[model samples]
Target: MPVTDVTTDHEALTMTLTAEFAASVDRLWKAFTDPAQLERFWGPPGWPATFPRFDFAVGGRADYYMTSPRGEKAGGSWEFLEIDEPRAFAVLDSFVDAGGAPADGLPTMRVVFAFEPTAAGSKLINTTYFTSAEALEQVVAMGAVEGSTMAFNQLDRVLAGLREYSAGKGTQTEILDDTHVRITRLVEGPRHLVWRAHQEPELMRQWLLGPDGWRMSVCEIDPAVGGRYRYEWEPLEGMPGEKFGFDGETLLWEAPRRAVTTEHMTGTDFPSTLNDLTLDEEDGATLITLVIEYPDKETRDMVLATGMTDGMEASYGRLEGVLERVG
Candidate 1:
């Protein structure tokens, strides 16, 4: 939601985007420089990214690729041209081959990243200069705008995790059983604030959605036992019947500590599951745990085959950013 605007100037042969993040300049800068952190949120949803080699210095190069759910890979490279730590940087962005070499007959662009302090937090302005207006239009048509937006959203999650770890919290995940999985994180915030993020629709909208170009058009929650809720997501541009949602009923509710819900995926034959969440305070941090249980092993395997675990991890990563803002 902090990604404010994106614009293109045909005459100037440039495209720019401005976004406000609930993080410090240093925290945000690290998200770009840190290879591991960059890889986590560098690609669009359903596609995980990897940075095989990253050298964040003037004249250095970064070789990376994003892998789709079907194992298809799209490679890219960045040639760093400027490095002003914690403030601004510039690079030459280009398409690359599997061996980390620039692809032939592809256009390269100059990208400048400027970070400025703001009253709320920090503002990041990205300006990309292309060789021609046609080049800019080509990239836009290839979903560059949407991909960059999703990448920034992932950066929000990275910043949040960095803040929590800096505050002495640890995050971990475990596969408890064939039909069960649990994720635990030490959130750097109060229990009540964390609970509010789960209950409030406005806060949920900020991080609940998985990727860019997809929005929660409907969010309804009732924080009482037997209360029903529904969240519907609609793509920015898609077919008429492409919309999907989740509808569920709260089985148990206890303020700021625990909640239990049974959720079903709409428009699908997927089996519903009971989600149990617990929060405990320790040393001024909230130790949060979420456990999801499916009906049986076969159903669990079917769900796992759909890549639900990776999606949930991505969503939880974004939740870190939400927590930092609310805290």
Candidate 2:
């Protein structure tokens, strides 16, 4: 019900609706692009959709049908016109028959979905252009407005479920062994960009901070075996001059692929830890795996109890944004 407005222009034969969702741009993008997720909310309540063929790319086609409470089915198809990942897309939407042919006398509209990042989360603008005022009125009279509102409302619930799933997946901390803890995430962007973000001092400052209002003040890295690196952070406003820092020695370095280091945190009871990072690329995305080894199980448990996993997850979320900007 966060839909701000729904407007129709008779002269232009267009209808536009605006709504906002409490989800990140990337997550909403998945809701629209992923077939399984799309089906979960693409129809109004009590009228679920099933997509038999969905190809989410430029020039791709999608064939789907929605079922009514009485078991009647209405088929539709989408001819993708353009796509800009996590931003916008356009398609020709039309009614279809069971045999996969266009239904006679049904209006075909040009539809556009635009996504924008906002303070709350993301804003979605949906616009549909018809060939004539009659076509627009015809669809509107057929409950297009109410149906869309209900479908979007359903989307809100779907996004909420996705958030719950992501929080669990993103915050998962696995004990690989008595001395090792590992965390992994599939990041959006190429492997090289992810690697550079980890290696370069300037890029590190953008996302290395674990929480909001904290900034990295010092970041120095020598990317070579046996080289030394140091990073420091301080609160941006409160507790003037209070700081935390870490210095490390690189034991192994492989550009854009792997890194191994021994890290010692200053001003902490924790012991020095061995950190290993591995990056793998697949189809324009990267999977980053980070493993940290402690001296013993007690040290690992102690660090985990300090909410270190939550902080690391927060830092990883910021890194996703940095990758988008630099990738």
Candidate 3:
């Protein structure tokens, strides 16, 4: 088992677990940051977790449910508080109701995950801070230590398989559910430059154009919470398709890491979709993950039918070129 030590301090109202893994810090960090990898082992042995929504950035939230063998489910939520790439992160963890809100009368704990380089590979110091001794006792009674240890034990298998699983997969899209889709791309570029390509209007204009025949006519961005951004596109001289634009307000903006926005088709009555974008860099390449939540299943199908993924792939192909020149 990876977990080497566990301790509880009643006076300090805290519990800590230390685990060592035969993987680099970056590998371990990606195991936690990537929702697809995280869900693989987040639950105990019998309970498999499904993270329907995971915005892995500061000021974001992750809603997940673990389903038991008997089909019973336990829901939980995490509000990300702090994130330091390849080093540490902290979150407020709580029991959540079906609607994903924190359940009443439930205790919330501040959990910090610290990653460090060790002689063999890497070490993880996971500490959970409870509000009081009573709260700590409540969790202990509920088998927190045993459950957490079981969850941690599964990480090694996941780490062992991740490289082969993700290698050379370029701009892939997965339908998460009826109304949600996740798109991921591993770009050969640094994180900050990738983020700037999305934020800066000049950089955006160079690559956000969907396909060869499309041109970005307008690219206005306000990179702040509650600020608005607008992108308009038109076909090149003799190409087909009408002029179209999209505008949205930023919901969360954590520099060079993550951003959430509400996107709307500029001239349509269709409901807006929530776009959550996150970037994580390991080695020299950055992994870009975008989770889009549509208003409903009908809207999702309609959008996908328009060859959205193909267009995005084309844009990302151009983006790599832009990154090459800028980088």
Candidate 4:
């Protein structure tokens, strides 16, 4: 696969995200333009969609809400700018309130989504505009980049599995970069037990880190396309700890299977790594692969140079212990 390029224009507070996937451009088109399909994989499970009606033609409108999996409401609107079959789409991505009201400073900006055929598959380019540098920065801080990329990722998966999509679990995930860590753990335990450890928060917290005074502040997961999940950690007392990290990461999470995460750690000098974890049941055991993608080559180099592979083995040992215990 070709690389996903992210180019920024600070003066205009704009960003252009370009990437290719293993599917045809036409297939990718419908997932974005069709209302029914959009709702199907738009948010993680439980994300409330409000498209009283969907108009895909020029001058048509589409609106959606990301209700917390528990049903708390959040909304946004889109106005089609230009649509060229299987080739491109342009629109205004406006952030709207619960009452469907647009705000100032956070003005609606133009979004241009282009599709191009490639030998390997299809390429997608997302160009988004903003009014000012500060506004762009604020939106990035608000997690816009991660969210949009993740949503596009969902679209990629749905298109790839269109035949089975009508009955299959949508997209798994694709590596956006070659940076970060890669770990392949061979498990001897039953997959069901390992699956629970991955899906259940309480089981996850124990093996992923030392249980000494470690607390998980947030493990909320909706677990479906367009659903939301956040992992927040805080320090606890009565523990011997390194200058541990305090952090949180939230992004689109599809359940029982697929998801994307943007992990940001504070208090430690670690770079943000986009983490993707996948599972497959082999025989009676589970095959789990965790891939962490760093922002740049330098970050990746630093991580690898730190003997990260050995460290991961140690961590997986902890995970194995937990899985066996739970099993």
TM-score of each: 0.53, 0.50, 0.58, 0.49
| Candidate 2 lDDT tens digits, 73-129 | 899999999999989999999999889888998999999999999999999999999
**lDDT tens per residue, model 4, 1-327:** 223776768887798888777777887677667775676446532232546557787898888876542235667788998989989989887888767778555667788989888887788888889888887788778766665565555454356443333223221222335554545565656656776776687886776553345566666655554445556655677555544443444454534333455566555567667666645443455546566667788887766677556555554567778977876
Question: Candidate 2: where is the Cα deviation over 4 Å?
Answer: 162-327
Supply candidate 4's per-residue lDDT for 110.
87
Clashing pairs in 2: none
Worst 10 residues of 2 by lDDT: 162-171
lDDT of each: 0.77, 0.81, 0.85, 0.63
Q: Give candidate 4 regions above 4 Å deviation.
A: 1-3, 43-50, 162-327
Candidate 4 residue-pair clash tally: 11
Q: Which sequence of candidate numbers ranks them by TM-score, best first?
A: 3, 1, 2, 4
Give the top-scoring candidate (TM-score): 3
Top lDDT prediction, candidate number: 3
- Sort by lDDT, top down from the best: 3, 2, 1, 4
Error of 4 at 319 (Å): 26
- lDDT by residue for model 1 (1-327), tens: 667898889999988989998889887888778886776568755344778889888999988887652346899888999998889999999988877777876679999999999988899999999998778889999888888876676466456663453344344555555767666666667788878888899988876776555677899998778889999988777634367899988877767766778889987888788777766554466656676787888886776677665565566667778888777
RMSD of each: 16.0, 17.7, 11.6, 10.5
Model 1: weakest 10-residue lDDT segment is 162-171
Between which residue pairs do clashes occur in model 1? Answer: none
